[model samples]
Target chain A: MPTLRLLAILQTDCPTCRLITPYLNKLAANATPIAAVSQDSEKDTSEFVRQMEVRFPIQRDPGFALSKRLEVVTVPTLYVLDENDRIVRQEPGFDKTALNEIATLLGLAPVATPYDGAPASKPGCTSRHLEVQTEDAAAAALDLHSPRGAKASSIQLADSDDPYEYCYRAFGDALPVVPPTAERVEKMLRAAARDPQEVIARIPPCYGEATVEKIAANAVMAGCVPEMMRVLIPLARAVADERFNAHGVQATTHFAAPLIIVNGPVRRELHFNSRQNLFSNTARSNSTLGRALQLILLNLGGARPDAIDMSALGNPGKFSYCIAENEEENPWEPLHVEHGLARDQSAVSLFASEAPHGVSEHNARTARGVLKSISYALATVWSYRACMGYEATVVLGPEHVHSIHHDGFSKQNVREFLFENTGVPLRCYSGDDPGEGFAQRGLYKEITIDGEPCYQKFRAPEAIKIVVAGGTAGKFSAVLGSWASGPRGSQMVTYPI
Target chain B: MPTTLVNPMNERAPQAAPAAPRLATLQGKTVALLDISKPGGSVFLDRVELLLKQRYGVTSVIREMKPTFAKPAPAGVIEKIRGADAVIEALAD
Candidate 1:
């Protein structure tokens, strides 16, 4: 007699699925007995397993491949496999009473694991699962449920019992979505003036076609309004810009991306928070717009985490890291204006940034004095180590900005001042222990300065980039360092929307 | 017309014989050592070069480098590799 391996593929939300999983678990617990799974409602299935204390392995098939392969048209399908893993008995929908009959055929004892399931954890304001505010709740819920490409007409609303909600939550998408209703999407589609099918950006090596409509759908999912799409289209173009190098940013194990910096009237027009918590999720414009770009990158460009992006420790920035420049506070010209764009024109500048390091100081009273403090803080090896020919971005808060401005130094003067002071001495660049294995690798070279053998040190002054950002409250400045030196240096590229 | 169920015997392949062992031919091949100018990248290439020189007598080496490590590999890198026998990329540390 051969052993039976019943692969129970069931949906977690189905009442019938919940009823039969325990018995199936018992069937699978034996050596070469069975393999039961709930492909749909993975959250409920995981919760069910935790609650029932089912020790048997229950694989989730979100892609619905295994279900389609076994011709499973219904939930709780049990496929009895022979010793060679061939399906001998295939049946859709679970039946606990049939276990005895099926057990006799396979010659196995029915041993159901005792139910000792854990309760659901209390939801709190942990960074992972922050609740959407009530005002934005309806829209956010719709965004998740009727994701952009979902059926346009009469989009299904997520009720308390919607299985899709649980599925979305388990997949790390929130429980609800503001479905892109046909009425809303059509309005947005009309704003574009191009055919919905018109291709905007060609996603790399996979060569997936991303049309304007598809990008609009993703924008809808990210909770972006249609007018934002004006900015989105060009921003997508910037990311796909051959020099922007989206492919290398996505493919490399190192940290890099297209950091969108908004300048001119659009920052104020879109209500992009250049103020308090500018980089954080305080403002809808910053959050959704940044999220829209990331979703397009993840879904359209196919730069999924751990797949194309092999970041050692991927940061929150990978989700979405974008901000607006505080143009009003700066004494010097705006970033776009500095890059040759008109002062009145709206533009977006893109740069590849590493995660930012926050430097806060309270004792400084004046701008140049504060920058000296900031320079000391910046020059400190912990936040940023000066690299030859590499660039770092300094985002200044309003307090630091006001302090610097009151001292009568222009932004250019400030940038030059930072460049001159924020670097370690030439002696420190040499390896303290030259006998170290890495030092012996001949990676670091020595220079004969004035006929004496000394270590080549001091990064070029242009490497330090100072840009003003943040709220009007604290005396804090954030520094984002360059991961590697580039041939073109860190030149800012701008696109006017 | 009736469908005929005729079984065709194996005529192309002779009676199953033990397959010959396969070996990689990396000897006497001119290998290109390309660098992107990053410290770790150059170090990794040097190690590969050492192995190729010490173990194998393939001494004809061609070396080139991209100006900066952060940038993409220059246009000629792939063409250079395409002409060689096998190309080993030292991506990063």
Candidate 2:
């Protein structure tokens, strides 16, 4: 089987593809042997070639499968591959100069088009492979071709008429999934630069090997488009880290979930919403990304709710909890930068956290006042004293950030202030102090050992992490406390994206 | 048109850990009660401590509480209680 050197990709549904069919025939007639790749069914392509009176062999690309690999976003795309299959000269769309250049490359006369005497140029229609139908179709186009028949574990429900059968039979996370078909999952895998068989980590409970291909299938079911694999792959790796203790996070009955905070260039590249509705369902990156991780937990990690995941009052974030740090406007170091990544490097910070509890502090005018408003919220983390040495995230909105930044407060300054201002009085630690029966069960009595009632809030300045996100209009902040922080539970893990 | 998706889950059967051998009796043995960081977990463990002392004839008892309830206990705490003849982990809201 000799590999063809010159290839012209087309679709029968495109008028430009039809207009250029004769020009392609003329080139083939000149002994150049230019192969026209049709992105249509065999019947439609044969009909097109028959109608055009062209004798050239038209190769069939059913479902535009091969066209997707050539990065053919529009029809009438052309590629001049070398004998070694390297694309030496490629032209996208129907530009006159590009067509003439191709004609020169094939040693043919400058090809004339249907509009050569009129406008001398024309625009081409969209390619069949890149059709986006929904508003949430914000993921970027994968720049590689999907392999044909590359699936191994796909379950074909041939007799079942219902397409959503997988959703009900334990594969679904109590929500309808987008059905991770082989074609869609292949597209998802193509988005990542990593190998599909590259094992990211061992998912817990089930301890399944999470290969790039396995995670891609879950990302597809979670409604993530192909490009989201950029964010999801690293996000999956962070949680799968044993230091993050994904197994403990899943087995615990606490209201814990993976809260992902994006940083650096990938946040903007993926269009994550760090402004209004930052915690709400506003952006496809925010919603589907966290959901993809959760789906991985269900499918690979085996942390299904009402089973291994025994949250007493499960937070809504279990559905999806991802956000980007407003790195553009942040006055302090971004989460990733503080965690040893370069300032410009893209990374994800993972925390085993409960759902966010909003801190509505509308009246604070000073930086100290803002910290004070947040300190009270920090005091309520994990039952006011039962869970000590835990962590919490204070998400400051743009308005609060402006105030804090104006007051010359760094992240360390805020953490110190919150740590000092947040703890309960020593009286609460003892049983006799205020209906002190709680001290008997195993509360840390040595946590506060001062002569007076001065108690310490967080274990260290590091535990009170400050992240800037949310809308600029609101003066609100939020507190997302840790879920059994320290070695006793899952610690935070951040990875460069 | 209907979509055909591949299974993302790991179908391999999870290797189950063998169960610990049951203790025959609690007579003259030290039993440790572990309290996770939640609120009512300690009260539950306190009651269990009384039952072990009164009914089981345990000679000694050690009670340890995690610094925080939201996570697993630290290794140091676990190591301290690992030597006990019997152990009971209590969990509550």
Candidate 3:
């Protein structure tokens, strides 16, 4: 007498697989001779069995040998084999009607009911063996040992579905993103030249592992070119550094986001916008690279805008805040060079800052005139009365830099002059104001500026970070205030690319 | 016909740890008040400590503070609080 058996191919991560567990258990209870194959590691398979309360025997399909032989394209696929091992019936995904028909064919009662709470029908996840790969030169350029070894799981979308809409609905940052197709991700991994499975950082507050493959997927979604990986890989490390305090930056109610400042040869090599429209969407590298990091933080770090990210009145820079220093127009050493890196070495600096506060000093011909105007704006950082504990990045326009440079004022001189002159007048602190007593807290020193008693804005000149950027024609400079500074708060971090 | 894409998210298989068993009674127990270093957190914990000692009959109260509210309590702080029978953490805006 020939016997019959039901074969089920599934993966632990597939939602349909878990959904169909009860039906499979029902078949098993009926003595229908069911054999389930799991395309997952033994550890995961065992966990799945325990969690789903699986009743049937499940054999692990190492290397997906059986799945490939059976040409399985989706999980929760069912095959009814005859006594001769010939397939009599095949079912993909979950269909209530199809399940009932199979139950009837097996001489058993209906497996699923309308009251089962399961959907009438649902598509299954793509079989892991069917993951797509590119066949172009870009794919050939990838190191098979690295990118193919990437550990990120795969998701399958129907060929007719709109990938853009699907990606936006599922994985977007409130914006349409390029679908991170496997081909595009592989191309990005090629540029990284690192193990795609390597964990770059664990982003807070969820502390998700920012693996190289995951970063590449985010980069693809942000529409970044392959070359941008050079900067992004290091930028990830910088943000994860304890001194950067990403948890504080992401969770604080204050308006703060990680600002990426690029310097050195890579800036020019990537055509990063350092001159005209420095902070705007003028350069692809500037726009996409900045956007990539934001996506990484959102997707991998789990800093969803409506969830863990509690920033009130979030800065527009959160969309994309990246700029390269205008090295040619800068009078002092570039930001990277100032940070102890050689002039030719490329590096990325991460700073937790609020939106840029623009200062129009168009008429200031002399360095002192420009510095004085900037000091007034600098005093307003954090709050006019709030002093110490905060830092600011002074992004000077090239025109302003030229004016200061021509006046024989070095970068150190500019920092010291700003520190000495930038202060809140003692009279501004009204007795009834809540922040009035900050000056007496011993956190700030009272200095006489213009013969008026004032509370100094910064504890030290080093608190002011200056970088020359923006169009050579514009007289507008900007100040980005820090969230919180020092050991307890976020500190600026620089990493070589 | 289906198109495939890599998952951009970090796959986390979080093992659910069981919560600590509830104490039957606070009598003769030592309660730890943890202030997360946020403003007003200490004031809230102070009241909690008083209530635990006076009303709940907690024999002793251990007052501890996290270095900052922005991150989790350091391991040293957690170890210090582990000696207490129960801990009440104050989170103040």
Candidate 4:
């Protein structure tokens, strides 16, 4: 085999170099060659070549010193340097120029075009504009020349005529999913810089490995596009945080799971529905972003029904529960910004929680009255078995925000008001009804001291985290309290993607 | 493959249980009632406790109801069940 030394120097928009790369690849395949990239290469030249599926011996130089040493100013520079380091001839660039012209000079027959009905002279490579034309032509030629074959008939677990419905039934999924195919999964893979095989975290109990590829597959199954993976990856990492206690969440009868909150420019960029119908399935990002998390839970973590996760009457949010912080409407700072993150930076925060209970305050004329209603709802502890203590989150809608802010109420003020007034007296929960599992667990009794029940007392002001979200439509906000978080009480974890 | 079907000339069908008096084996057995809440759970447990004593020879039934439903069940509940011969979770609303 003969070794040909080739060097290509590029500009931001080089034509001849683009046209010759594929030809060089073909030439390299027929003969041994060394392709050294010059430092003066275009910003995306290497990437462009990679996308074109050109595979050949190549090197890149950050500086064009090599090109200068070769004294090759004109590009698409073709030099047929033999193994002995002797230049047979130096062609400034190819332009309908030939192997025959060089072959005649080197005493060899003109090289054939490797294609049928080919001419001795190909085409002028001098015209930089001819690259795209010939490149498309060559691509079409390759497509025609390549062998045609039928797809293999193989039944895969994730494959079905009705992939979404089938996978949902197979996994006993709470919500339907978009079946993940190899092509779609591969698309999701493009969102991350991480290697497909790199293990991000291990799912609890089942100890299933969650690799970048696996998460991407689940994201695809969850109907996530490549762009959605940016949000999904961070949400997965947040829940996988050891402090999140995914193991206990799945194993315990508590119907609590991860609640995703996004903060950053990505919210607007991804068009997260933080406006009207924010939490509803009204927008693509809203549904798919949340669905991506669910898919990861089902396929990667194996949190299937009647299986590892024993959630009785599992809430619909289990399918996907995520919302972007209404940074624009928040009276103070956004949730992420309040947590010491930059206002403009993007991040994902996970909180262990149950389904949200709406606190409607449509008639409240003043902030105090509205706070009283919210406080009443916040104190209603129906789940007395929760001994790990209690933490509440207030997701304020825009209408509610205006009413409260107009009355000079801050989010902290709302939290304090809820902390001070929300709980009911112990007697309200004490009863003969058999379904009161929380009181039967002695949670109220634990809060009692000195012969007086302290159930009405606020455990801590910090127990309540107030976040503003939802659409601007109604004066209704939701009060979502944590399930019995057990030993590992709910913790908010934030991760940057 | 052809589907197969059988037709019986007699056409006898399965019969339901007869209306006879049947004795319940759960009678006279001591049961433990535990829950995750206090007042509401104890109310349910009280009814369960009364039922156990009246219908069965459960003269001495120990009952424990948790204080809060929001927290996970404590270790004591499991330990109490371990000592009892049988346990019934008194789930009350």
Q: Find the candidate with the highest DockQ and give its number.
A: 3
Per-candidate iRMS values, in order, are 22.1, 3.2, 1.4, 18.3
User: What total of clashing residue pairs does each candidate reach?
Assistant: 13, 9, 0, 63
Model number with the top lDDT:
3
lDDT of 3 by residue, A221-340 (tens): 999999988888888878877678888899888899999999999988898988888789889999999999999888878888868887778989889999898888997888888888
lDDT of 2 by residue, A315-433 (tens): 79888999999977798898888888899999888888888899887888899988788887898887775435678988889899898889998888888878767766656665544
Listed in order, the DockQ scores are: 0.01, 0.31, 0.47, 0.02
Residues B1-93, candidate 1: write the lDDT tens digits: 211111111111223445333426657877778776655787788888888888987656666676655556754565565456555666564
Ranking by DockQ: 3, 2, 4, 1
Instruction: Name the runs in model 2 displaced over 4 angstroms.
Output: A1-152, A385-388, A426-453, B1-3, B17-93
Question: TM-scores of all models?
Answer: 0.61, 0.65, 0.73, 0.55
Which stretch of 10 consecutive residues in model 1 chain A shows the poorest summed lDDT?
A139-148
lDDT (Cα, tens digit) per residue for candidate 4, span A1-497? 46445444433234445444454555555544536453333545565555334566455544455565676556656666777877766665443345335444444444433221121222222223222232222221111111111121223542224655655555555666555566666677777766765555555534355666777766666666688767766676577665566665665566686778888899888888777767688878877877777666665566666776777767777767887888788887778776777788898877778888888888987878877778767765435323226677788887888888898877777777766665544555555753443433454333433354545434577677878887777788888877544344546667765
Which candidate leads in TM-score?
3
Candidate 1 total steric clashes:
13
lDDT of 4 by residue, B47-93 (tens): 87887788777856767665444335654566566556577675535
Query: How well does candidate 3 match the true structure in TM-score terms?
Result: 0.73
Question: Model 2 over residues B47-69: C-alpha lDDT tens digits?
Answer: 98888889989888899988766
Q: How much RMSD separates candidate 1 from the native structure? A: 25.4
lDDT of 3: 0.84
In model 3 chain A, where is the ten-residue run with the lowest total lDDT?
A: A138-147
Instruction: Name the lDDT value of residue A66 in candidate 3.
Output: 97
* lDDT of the structure predicted as candidate 4: 0.60
